[model samples]
Target chain A: MPTDHIMKTYDDELKRLNNAIIRMGGLAESQVAASIQATVKRDSELAHEVVEQDAQVDALEAEVEALAMRLLALRQPMARDLREIVSSLKIASDLERICDYAANVAKRSIALNQAPVAKPVYAIPRMGKLAQALIKDVLDAYVQGDADKAMHVWLSDEELDELYTSLFRELLTYMMEDPRSITAGTHLLFMAKNIERIGDHATNIAETIYYLIHGTPLKEARPKRDRSSTSVVLPGPVAVATTDSEETK
Target chain B: MPTDHIMKTYDDELKRLNNAIIRMGGLAESQVAASIQATVKRDSELAHEVVEQDAQVDALEAEVEALAMRLLALRQPMARDLREIVSSLKIASDLERICDYAANVAKRSIALNQAPVAKPVYAIPRMGKLAQALIKDVLDAYVQGDADKAMHVWLSDEELDELYTSLFRELLTYMMEDPRSITAGTHLLFMAKNIERIGDHATNIAETIYYLIHGTPLKEARPKRDRSSTSVVLPGPVAVATTDSEETK
Candidate 1:
């Protein structure tokens, strides 16, 4: 075959991979949306659908990997082609994880339905909406190769983080106030965490998009705002707490 | 250059990539170990060291990625060589995440030192040791191409998951019994969760090694035993709770 013919065929294969990524992203976004709906509505059926649908995302990721490996071996993609192909693998993995977290949230929603739903459970959908938007924007950024849009998604994740921290405190305080609510509150905490992690994966995809477009890593430190890792909520009427102490210094 | 001479240089380059992965694995293992030590001893300095050392793991992962991409483009490796190179990208990414989780554990440890230590904090080091061993064994499996050894690491992760679930219950129960311990218990919960995630990444590396050596994906459902997400521990004198409800059914 002529080199021109081979090159054109390789370009087509790359396009196929790109389309597969977009499809995978669509599945992930719906999974996140449906999972959050399941939690808020206490719809076990929708949650079950989300959990079962994760297999499709995993299968798509496997397909992307096989196609990528074949392209690397046969076409020997270099420079821009190589970066795009490599970024696809990383991006697919991140999407797979985002779907996994969505499924996890769905799983916890089923558990949450066992007890009286806590008041804070409503906050899950609000956070979920933000995460879903980030996934959508990041996927758009990925498909269009828009670094600025991807950067916007990256910066927007701080809001989700802030929301998660407030929810974390609320759930703990709720659990303490009504010991019976502890069961539901714990599940909600994990569900919220799953959504927060989905946001993080969106940020990761943004970084991958930035790298793919610029051929260089985004150099600025990420604007991370999740302080829940060190957060402490004391159980009392005063409810006063220290976020950190000198021992950490 | 002769084809034979070019093949020799490619072989050397592959060896260099292999060495870098091993070095990256070593750093991740130590980070897990030191981060656990920091938590057990409440040593802020040691925790700080683990946090600082994560950058080396990050740098080494970047080096592996660059080398893998170079080999894929320049060598145009086929069959086993292609699989090995591709697997390095995945394995390095998993190791990098293991280090990130380790750093997270270290960060939580520093925060934990600020408050009264919970009795359940001691379970963290136990879980950490299991996770560290898994990392070491999986690294050896990757380097030696020992699928059986990798499978061992894969199965042993169940034990870590089981341990984490028990710790999750213990911490929640402890917090309920003494409301004053809630702050410390929350930090300990995250630390244990981080260690459990480290174990998960080790399992991920083991799966990559299995595929690399066998040329077939491991089709069996992993013996996953972490039920903490659905776990609901009620607060009462009897301290009894249901793990799940019919809504999941």
Candidate 2:
């Protein structure tokens, strides 16, 4: 009876840890959504709210860390339990980073508001929506212990990357065509990059969830389609001409 | 004698874990330096090499993770050993990310070489050198268990951020002035941001080391001076004149 009681208590603690991560994930999801809305609306107050809410995510991470450490030290959990605990820590860290990137998008949105919104600025909310979906799906995967769902999120990151690459080119063209848009364009570019990175953190969480359920890291190389790192958009007449063609399309 | 022998073996495993982190740290340092060299010298071959070396860092991270998990399960390490083990996992993850940023810089460098070099490119090596030093000093702090030294690296991040802010403004002005430079300037902008992020990972490692040694998180607010997020440089006369004043100075 005593052992059964202790086992129940351990289960409760583990559930508490899981709930903390889920709560943290919810905060991250909201922050990303709010930041994107703020960027699109040019609403500084909403941006500030996103920034303020990030502290809560950070606090949740600290709380999860403490509880995880205590469980590891006291419970001496083994096998699946140990993996679950470790994955929780990793997942929390990724969620914390996701929130940070969202806050960064908000910060840039504040600066971006100073200038007239660039045409490419509209691409952000689309990208933001994709990243938000990924976060939501990955958290659901975590909650359900659904490796298939997690794997789906992992593979879907490629679409986000492709979207980002196209947006990168568009932003560069917009900036070069109207030098006036450079300030806004650059801020929007970084904001897009930040959202792209949030998609990445969601991929990271998906991987952690897969590992937690399967006990092995995803072996194949993750599909990395974010060629924006190596992307080049030439300036002057050529870039402007390209934009002109696109506009006709 | 049996307990003593087990204790000695446990000590050996911990030492090996520490050495693996040090080795991993060395790889990260080399990747950053080589990437920077490639960027400054426009050496595509060296950049390729930096990209190739990133896999080794990734492999080491997996190895560290495996070993840490094994130790936790078998050793049931408590208190300081547990903290050290956990910190190793965290530090390895940071180093892995540092290498990823370095690889990204390399990737961007390859693209950057396609265009004629931008003048702002010269500042990359300065930033790179600073990031390289922070990595080196932070690793030494980890090795020596020197919290004070770790704090030093932690604080030095502000200088790197300040440098990045100036480089950012300069790059934006250059791009607006000559659209031809936009291609190279954007690449350089990303490369500089990559190096700045490397500095951030060093600060993360320093914090991990501090926690490992002191068993308490640094309570003070980390001084963050990277205002480039909200930084804006308008296009046209205002920005050009700002550059002109700086040129005279």
Candidate 3:
């Protein structure tokens, strides 16, 4: 094939690969959302669905790996293209692991259903939403190659941590007050912790974006919570860019 | 340079890089161990030592990265060398993150020093030991290029999960029986969870080994725990091959 033809084909392959990863991301994110809903709504069926679908997540990861390997072996991708391809592989693994933690959360939710919750789980649901949103934004950032947006996702981790900490304190109070609260309160804590981990995985993805573009790891990516230069109004979430702020909404 | 000389130089650089990573692993392992000691024994000074040493850990990471980058640019390595170098980058990042978690745990310990712990923290010390052992084994495996040994570290994640679950239950039980246990017990639980995460970082290294060597992803690493065939002696730790089964005296 001609060089132009090959370049065009490689570009197309890269697009397909990114789309496949986003589709996987959608699945992973929904697992987290459904898992939270399973606990909040006491829906064993939804929890079960999350559990059963883990295998599908696993399979998708394998497919992504296979696709990445095929591209690397055939294309001999260089520099930026290499970074983008490698990032996909790493991000897919990270997403798959996120799904596992989400599944674990759902399983714990089901297990805790037998006992009364130690206290109302008001914070966990919000924290879950926040984490899920951060992950969504990170995925959006990646598809659009938006580093700044990815950094925004990175900044969101602290809020999740704070919410998790509050939930931790509340559940501990309930458990301390009544022996019967032990079983369920413990499960809730694990669920919250699992969600916190999901946020960390999203942060990992953002850090990878920094690497893909600059070949330099951001030593500290925690968005300046106090806000100095973080508030850039980039193009709405879909125009792809070679840089980190492209909006792939 | 002749291929032989180039090969010799590349081999030397890779070995040096690997040694640097192992040294970093040793420091991280000590940080976890020392942090736990400080927390459990209320040794504030030891906690400070770990904190003070973290900058050194960060420095080591920077040095290793500079070395790896120089090797990549100078040697223009082939695929296998490329894999080794990339794995070094990732493993260092994971180790650095693990150390950060250890320091965070110690920080929480400092906070908890304001009051006595409600119960003996049996699970945390054990979890730390397990995590340390996993890191030791994975580093050993990677250095030796022993796929089987690496596989065992990968499966060891289940052990961490099981330990975490038991710790959660035990902590919850303490809190249920005593309200004063709430704050201390919750911090302890998060600390234990951090230790468990160290095991996870080791598992990530193991998967990286599989990818670098076999060029395939082990997607079902978690759901199926039967990967003993990849170990050094594992019909039991790796000697049997089960070094982990060695008497914990």
The lDDT per prediction is 0.85, 0.86, 0.71
Q: Which residue window of length 10 is worst by lDDT in model 3 chain B?
A: B240-249
Residue lDDT tens for model 2, B117-206: 778988999999999999999999999899999999999988998899889888888888887777778778888888889999999898
For candidate 3, what is the lDDT?
0.71
Instruction: Give one digit per residue, the lDDT tens place, for model 2 in A61-178.
Output: 9999998998999899999999999999999999999998999898888887777767788789899999999999999999999999999999998889879888988888887888
| DockQ of all models, two decimals each | 0.44, 0.44, 0.19
TM-scores of the candidates in the order shown? 0.94, 0.95, 0.80
- Once superposed on the true structure, which residue ranges of model 3 sit more than 4 Å away at CA? A221-249, B1-9, B55-79, B155-163, B214-249
The best-first sequence of candidates by DockQ reads: 2, 1, 3
Candidate 1 Cα RMSD after full superposition onto the native fold (Å): 2.9
> For candidate 2, what is the DockQ?
0.44
The digit string of per-residue lDDT tens for model 3 on A1-249 reads 699999999899988888889999999889999988988888878987887888788788778766766676577676777777778877987898789888877776666565555364666689889989988999898888888898888877777766765565566556555545555665676677778778888988998887777877788636322110011111223221111221100
TM-score of chain B of each: 0.95, 0.94, 0.83
True contacts kept of each: 0.41, 0.59, 0.19
Task: Please provide, for model 3 over B1-249, each residue's C-alpha lDDT reduced to its tens digit, 9 standing for 90 to 100.
Answer: 698997887789888998899899899889988988988788877877776788788888887877766665566565677677767877887888789778767766665675575574766778888888888898888878888888999887778766765565556556555556666676676677677778778888888888778765565535332121111211111122211211000
Best by lDDT: 2
Candidate 2: segments with Cα more than 4 A from true spot: A237-249, B239-249
Q: Give me the displacement of residue B34 in model 3, in angstroms.
A: 1.4
Q: In terms of DockQ, which candidate is strongest?
A: 2
